[model samples]
Target: MPNATGGQPPITGQVLFYKDPQPLSAENHGGLGVRQIAEPFAFLRAAHAVPVTVTEFGVAAASYPIIFVGDERTPVAVMGVRQGQNLFVDQNGYVFEDYYIPAFVRRYPFVFAADESSDRLLLCVDRAAPMVSNQPDVPFFENGQPSKFTTDAIEFCKEFERQRRATTDFAKIVASMDLFEQKTVTFQPRDPQGREVGPVQKVADYWAISEERLNALPAEKYVELRNNGALGACYAHLVSLLNWSKVVNRAVRTPPPGQAVS
Candidate 1:
């Protein structure tokens, strides 16, 4: 079962792009406002991977490798091969042009918090976000009621919560089938002269659905997966692995000095 507080725990200790997340309330932040998000993705500069909802598999697969992580088998869109480096985000905090931004990134600063006791979901915002303010721009509340912007944000968060629950269920199905396997992605590093040096470096090692195992599933189970819409998502994940090369190429073009490109 998903946690009543949503699928994962609350944002804490620099989870992804959020700095300080606080539950929205009439008393503590009735006068706060959020400046229009001019740089929608400036906060994602330091994130190499972002959680992705199941519905985004088709579009996310086209731009980044989709993989599962951790014991929960949470799906993620891989943006970089190295830690603390996001190939898609430039130094200026601008996401690369033409990339399909995930909903997880688009819904930044606002999230839904489910109260276990009351079974109620509360809308929350990151207090430390640059867009949050008190002096103007777009107020969260107008005349003691939620402003249009706040309403829209709440709607977006609600939809994301729905999708997140679906994703969690899908992950459980996949795990139950025992289709995942540990996979290692290796890269050949080059010296200053652009000549290959050292043995091939293992860039990343993570679990993914094994194609062989998937193909070997019983006919009845296979049909069940297809009927439940997991088949398409599984295929999308397999196809997205090809994009790992693209990540490596982008990193090579702007190689960080020393220690084999950070």
Candidate 2:
């Protein structure tokens, strides 16, 4: 979807699956609404990684190897080793096992865009989304006010915005401490005989919190992190790194189309 104010880039860049994002308003979308879809999450099929708020580190840690990426140090849940595949989600839009679903996925088709002129947040939807219907069973508005479904969606987007702010603050705190380091996840091919074969493969490289630096911090600075709620997030991120093996193994089990399958 386009950005919140329409067509322009998102002020907040996590607009992962939105293709034609447009601000929701009674005048513009009085008749548009969403419908139930057999594959509500089909959009996630190609999204190998998605942004996650700091609050999600505790729960998302169990399912995704939470890693920091990009110049912004934005945290993302690694779903697939390759760029275009999501190992946990199948072609039919089925999520394998009981993997922790990120709120970013669940909040699809609806997002908040900032109105730069007034500095207000506007709720937007991906009009190109398969579930968005011109004649929706549940309309976006009723009697000139937002319908209950629309109201609920608005609340969800608002909560996500709140979480986004908190996550930004946490990232700043971590950056200020200079605790991030370059990290990589790799795979080594093996033969049927269970012996190592071929060259050691670098699956992906990104940023991660440095445990060594964290432990070496001054006592008062360490206490400051603990008091700021970042200490737990640091541990959560470090603990989550153990799951990188799972991502590598999954890529080996079902390598993307061009890659050699293990």
In lDDT terms, which candidate is top?
A: 2
Which residue pairs clash in candidate 1? none
Model 2 scores a TM of 0.91
Query: Could you give candidate 2's per-residue lDDT for residues 143-192 as a string of tens digits?
Result: 77788888888888888888989998998889999999998787889999
lDDT of 2 at 193: 95
Per-candidate clashes come to 0, 6
lDDT of each: 0.81, 0.85
Alpha-carbon TM-score of each model against the true structure: 0.88, 0.91
Question: Can you write out model 1's per-residue Cα lDDT over 26-111, one digit (the tens) per residue?
Answer: 56777898776566567786678899998999999999998899999999999877676678986566788889899988887887
lDDT at 97 for candidate 2? 68
lDDT of 2 at 14: 47
Q: Runs in model 1 with CA error above 4 Å? A: 1-14, 37-39, 191-195, 257-262
* Candidate RMSDs in order: 4.3, 3.3
